[model samples]
Target: MTKPIKILSFNIQSGMGMDNRRSLSRIAWVIKCSGADLVGLQETDKYMKRSCFSSQARKLARLLGMHYVFGGACKPAFFSRFGNTILSKYPIKGHKNTLLPGTGEQRALLDVLININNKKIRFCNTHLGLSTSSRQKQVNKIIELLGEIQLPTILTGDFNTTPNDPVIEQLRACLERKSVSTESKNNDLKTYPSDRPSEKLDYIFLSAHWKEICQTTLPGQASDHLPLLAAARFIS
Candidate 1:
């Protein structure tokens, strides 16, 4: 029997009016068309330039009929900026959203618990810093934050660092410490440079506690970056 779990991670580029100034609809379309069970969104900016309207997070959730979560870019979120957001079709048990310890355009890690057929799956999503050095620090902070989570986990997001980078190497080591079989042959799909992709800054890594059945990148253009999706069967 085959149980397919559709997971997707996208850095929507803050919807900075690039899609004919139709950010909300674009996001909704992506959510609807992609048909993801769980989605991790980076650069999921939740506010208008003037902060007059509802958050983009709430708007997108309402549109997709999914539970929503957001991690503010600041530790205390002094400026009330959006960092990362997660949308889940399944009922959420709980979540932890917080900013990474760094001084940049504001970044955060969102830890959410999702109930899948009476089983809980933990998702850790985040968008890392832009610079290499900043990304290193951000990756370290993410690792630190992840240590607190006690559940079957799937780390998905636009980490902003390629697999070759030292930061990414360290992150890979610290996370997914348990070795799982990788049956995916689509690891070569690049996700950045939206127009014509190159390099993989996004990923969906399984925890030792779960057995990944399949993984691949969704094909289509819904945003600046392509989405990375994976399906895993929990080991009982």
Candidate 2:
């Protein structure tokens, strides 16, 4: 029997919680408690003064004892960069970062290949733009990239849009929404504005080769957005 893989997606808002506190340790603690074998993070800062110039991705990986790769969507300053990151308990074999089409703040898709249980699997992490037009274009680009990968893939991120949005609808046509559950009660799928989550912005999509076991949002004030966690086993 194959072990179920635990996956998590979170938009940490540079480690700022709803209470306006910035603590990477808190974020790490939430992830650690989740016991996620794979984690995709958005809005991470690298050498940014606002977050005390800490390398958020590296620090979290170190704290959790995992391998990680960061993709900078934009460099607001010469020494500071912000973007998405992926952490895995397994070894990362390769990675690529591509900037998406957007008129507002730059966004990126981080594609990574990792060896999990001696099997290669592709993991893609991204953060979409706020505008509908930009999100449409970004979604198109993501779909295009997804077509090029042959391995069983898992895509996770903070899409900045609700589940009913057309962008999400388009993605559903190509991949399975692994984080959504029919049995969820009391709006458990909502992941934004952690204090009072009223929107479903974060998501995890998996290829047909995986079967979802369970999914839920982790409770924590580590960031403005709550973490989405899911477990699945490879069908093959």
Whose TM-score is greatest here? 2
Lowest lDDT block of 10, candidate 1: 45-54
RMSD (Å) of each candidate, 1 decimal: 2.9, 2.4
What are the per-residue Cα lDDT tens digits for candidate 1 across 42-143?
Answer: 876544453344577888899999998887774333344667888999898899987776667777789898988887888889888788878878888888
For model 2, give the 10-residue run with minimal summed lDDT.
179-188
Cα deviation in Å at residue 82, candidate 1? 2.0
Candidate 1 TM-score to native: 0.86
Clashing pairs for predicted structure model 1, backbone only: none
How much lDDT does each candidate structure score? 0.74, 0.89
TM-score of 2: 0.94
CA deviation > 4 Å runs, candidate 2: 177-188
